[model samples]
Target: MINMQMRNIGIMAHVDAGKTTVSERILFYTGKSRRIGDVDDGTTQMDWMEQEQQRGITIQSAATTCFWHDTHINLIDTPGHVDFTAEVERSLRVLDGAIAVFCAVGGVQPQSETVSRQANKYKVPRIAFINKMDRVGANYQSVLTQIAEKLHLNPLPIQLPIYENDNFAGVIDLITMQYLVFDESTQGATVIKESIPATYLTSAEEARTAMLDSLSTYSEEIINLLLEETPIPEELLISEIRKATVTRQIVPVMMGSALKNKGIQPLLDAITYFLPDPFELGSVAAKKIYKNKSEDIQVIRSESDDFIALIFKIQQDKESGALCYIRVYAGSIKAGTMVLNVGKDKKERIGKLYRMHARTPEQMNELKAGDVGVIQGFKLAQTGDTITNGAPILLESIQFPEPVISIAIEPKTIADMNKLKEVLTILQREDPTFIHKENTETGQLLISGMGELHLDVITTRARDEFKAQFNLGKPQVSYRESVESSSQATETFERPINGKETFAGLTLSVKASERGSGNKVINGLSNNVLPENYQAATIRGIEAALSSGITLGYPCLDVEVTIEDAVYNEDLAHEVAYQSLGAMLTEKIASNASPILLEPIMAVDIEVPNEYVGDVISKLTSRGGIVLGMDMNESIQIIHAQSPLTKMFGYSTELRSQSQGRASFSMKFSHYEKKLS
Candidate 1:
């Protein structure tokens, strides 16, 4: 029955597309919330962070549960800002489907395309909700065209908007030939279905025909009914659409002004009716080791089967400690159950389970297959960990990009020093993208993240949530070191350990790798001369030595190390001997390889009016920018460029000044390039 009754879904869209608003409406209509909370007022339930409320954007992905009909829907609302794409990434990793929200006026924005690609990567089926239709210049057809052209989607509109004097009234369901108008007096809690109006009949018919024509390719029954001119049963049509959508063959489109309370009920109906139930998605694939060899196999859902789950999110909860949000894939788990964290190779007991609604928690006794719940008592739990009760199975984990910028944060007073360090540890545990480091030479703590806003959010949280008062230092660009040319060196270590002569010799080769291909080391020695464990020790030593570059103490990147040769006394062929020799050779390799500095280049997207195009371009170019692409969006010019991160400091201020505060931009780390001489 879990196969037919569960929908693990999320709400995703670009910023200002009304995703949180739609979520608010869902929570209220489903009785999860007593009253609607508006984002403008900073009272939205899904956006629960103070930074999120003040900035009016979601900073963390929030999960909640509600019922739609007989089906249980676990909805996750994810952030839309480019810096927080990591949150979106981890959420999509565990979700079976999503709701793609599009602004009727803004259409398919840049982030829209980005998230579409992310969904496609995870093969998550989605239904498109055309929102903000009540706004002026809200053209449904225009968005449809953009969805097809920009996102390369097969978009099928199942509902046609009913506009009265350019104001959104309701929607005309194409399949049922009925018009739906929400009860304004009830705040859209009740729906009144009526016959299609005479003026909208032609458009509704055209839309239904278009939808059926596209869905026909996936179902022979639909083709037969369409060819015979027979009335297509709504259930049969919905089944076919569900099949095609779950396979990502097509995206069903629904229209609404979520903030104005229009078309939300039908959208919810579509989610349960069209998205795949967990059992329908069937088994999950995991890697198992047999006879020291790994193979991928399916883990089907069954409460009686072996327990398996993935920890896709980790959050620090005041009431429950670390709330590890798990997506159970194969079996049942409950309090007191002992599960092995296969990724960490450690065992942990499930202390308690919770059903989260933003900051609120509802305690549960157990969770079965395909359910999402939070659990505590896991001190070592981390995002992307696979935990199982029966066997060791490894699932593909989420990959996060390296942090591109860093800042030094020092406590304002001696009393807050330990508090700041403790909170930093908590933040690092919760967010895998957040990296903390210490400047050993200067005795200062440095925190690194994807962008400035990311670091700003962390510091703000450090102050507000943890009460760790701190002062921020200048934002620092994260530089890297790489070999500019191929070079080789040799080192011999002769030492006395425990009154025994320990001698080891090794040769290392350094070669330049393609830009963005991070540091790597490989054993080029023959096992006949060296043991596998000793070679492994050498690799570990090389990795450690590369962490601090030869010049300027930056981390190394885009370089390759090779263990060209090695010789050691059989009696003294120990791990330490090889490791010591390896470290010595790495220093020699760095000196001979012509190590050079590499700086991060960010992919920036800027949108501004035509009048300010020249000014914006001039400012970007002055920051060592290179124009990659440009397009015209209505009256705005969208310029895509790459610039060194060092030159992008205070860009937001300068751009607003250049464009009279009417322009906006988003940027993310792109690639590492050689610093200009």
Candidate 2:
């Protein structure tokens, strides 16, 4: 078996920060590739997708494995764009650590801060890389200061750039007191390690002394050694730095230009030296049910424990059909094994196991704990489903944000309509956030997602991959309905023919709750007037009525309904009569319930040049946005605000035009709020 100490790390950064370029350097230096592929020319090995090449941006996360020294590293290169955040979130969930790349010239931009916040939330240990030192106006020290002040990171520089701008030559490794030069003699390739340059010796020593001072706080022994001016063992100091990083106390910042092929070796060394191994992360926490009836709670740890794996992503490949990507939490998973899907309470047999290599799959016989692999032919398995040995265990399901934007779609032809349902069903299964439901009142097939790009990609996938052609109506703003105040009303629908009589009556009161609480129904009828079964049927009818809004035909939320009174004849009453009466009574209540429109609200983060900050804020306010907060670093400002989704349909293009293509923003669903009168 491979060493359990292997760590899976992800390289994440803001767009145009050279994240993909950094990844390419890592691959090249590690001998994974004979020649480095540049992202500018659309020839990067990791960014292999057609859309990525055409758009000059990463659209999906790519995974690859390489060895640094003796430690095996599974690295994932994630897209920096906000549109592909789902990919980043899933990758973060499985990675042990992350390398956050920041452009030295730009410092920490909008997406960089946003992703940093996400990484902090996930409690993932990270190392910061200040890249692009070869670019003009690149100040490594200024960027480090920005990280400390803006990002609230206690950054200690482990490597310093030797020179800046066009004369950029090498980096001084503070830890080992070595100077590493980038050799362009071999086609702008190869990293050469050598002694520190005479001019940089004093600067390197000063930086190393400062690093030791920073480390002193983490250990009293280090402080004492520093105070006595005693020499500290290099290996011991490296071990302490790793411990501090794992504890999230210190972030070792390194500087180099990936474009120049400089500082790549030092960064790799820092990764293998500082990042914690999977075994160091301890066992994956999973709730397991005990065999004894008396005990209900148990926690499983490693492969020696009972087998358990959680499916984090699911995809419907064109040729391979359905594939479920899972992270093994405990024990070993093998082919032809029957695992119980604790979420669905169904047993599925794992037909084959494979390791994902980009879009290709390499067959594997078994996978141990802390490994990520794919299982085929498990039709019942889904993303977030927990698979375990028959022993029952309930794991928390993955939570996704509610979609704020929606589009109404329909088949253009009868042939397309015949296959639309199947295609849509598969799409919904792949992405939980992509909701598809038929509106009972309007009979429109509404599809909702995080934003316009998200829905567009899904529609494109449907047409290209599923071979289904359809017409999409103008993207409509998703509106909701809710009651303003409490109100009560009574209605009766009685049908009698030739002495055969069926009678049903109900009195209901509708009250509005806090925004986003959704609708709640209560049965207040006495047993003497109506049975419990009859009241349940009435609740179902009310649910059906509220699903499609009474006004613009959208769903309703944040309203409460109660059946205050009900009467039914035991001999003459039927279930159909109660259902019909409930429907009629609900419509009657809605007529006087004082329903109001609610629009979808989004949490937006905008990063723009200092000159355009005022313009961005003014435009947001003009569009009815509520500026929550503002953060400024260097020449860029990060504006956090909440705005109506309707106003943001084409804002990307507008923002690019207004800012002269120097600004970018990311927005996600926050919560639904009432529209102003």
- Best candidate, lDDT: 1
Q: What overall lDDT, based on C-alpha atoms, would model 2 receive against the true structure? A: 0.81
lDDT by residue for model 2 (102-162), tens: 9988787767776787778767888999998888778888888878887888897888777
Taking all chains together, each candidate's TM-score versus the true structure is: 0.96, 0.85
Candidate 1 lDDT, 1-677, residue by residue in tens: 44348899999999889999999999999899999999999999999988889999999999999998888999999998888999999999999999999999878887888899899989899999999999987888989999999999889889999988777999998878899999999998899999998998887888888888888988899999989999988888888888889888899999998898888899999998899888778577789855566889888877788889999999998767899999988889889899999978899999989989998889999999889999888999999999999888887789888899999889899898888889999999889999887787888999999998988898888888988888999999999988887888777778877777887888899888888667789888878978788888888788877886766788888878899898867886667777877876786778687888999999999988999998899879988999998877667788999999999989999998888899999898888888986
Candidate 2 Cα outliers beyond 4 Å, as residue runs: 1-4, 164-166, 186-189, 283-285, 289-298, 487-594, 605-621, 625-642, 659-662
RMSD of each: 2.0, 4.7
Indicate the residue-level lDDT of 13 in model 2.
89
- Model 2 clash tally, residue pairs: 2
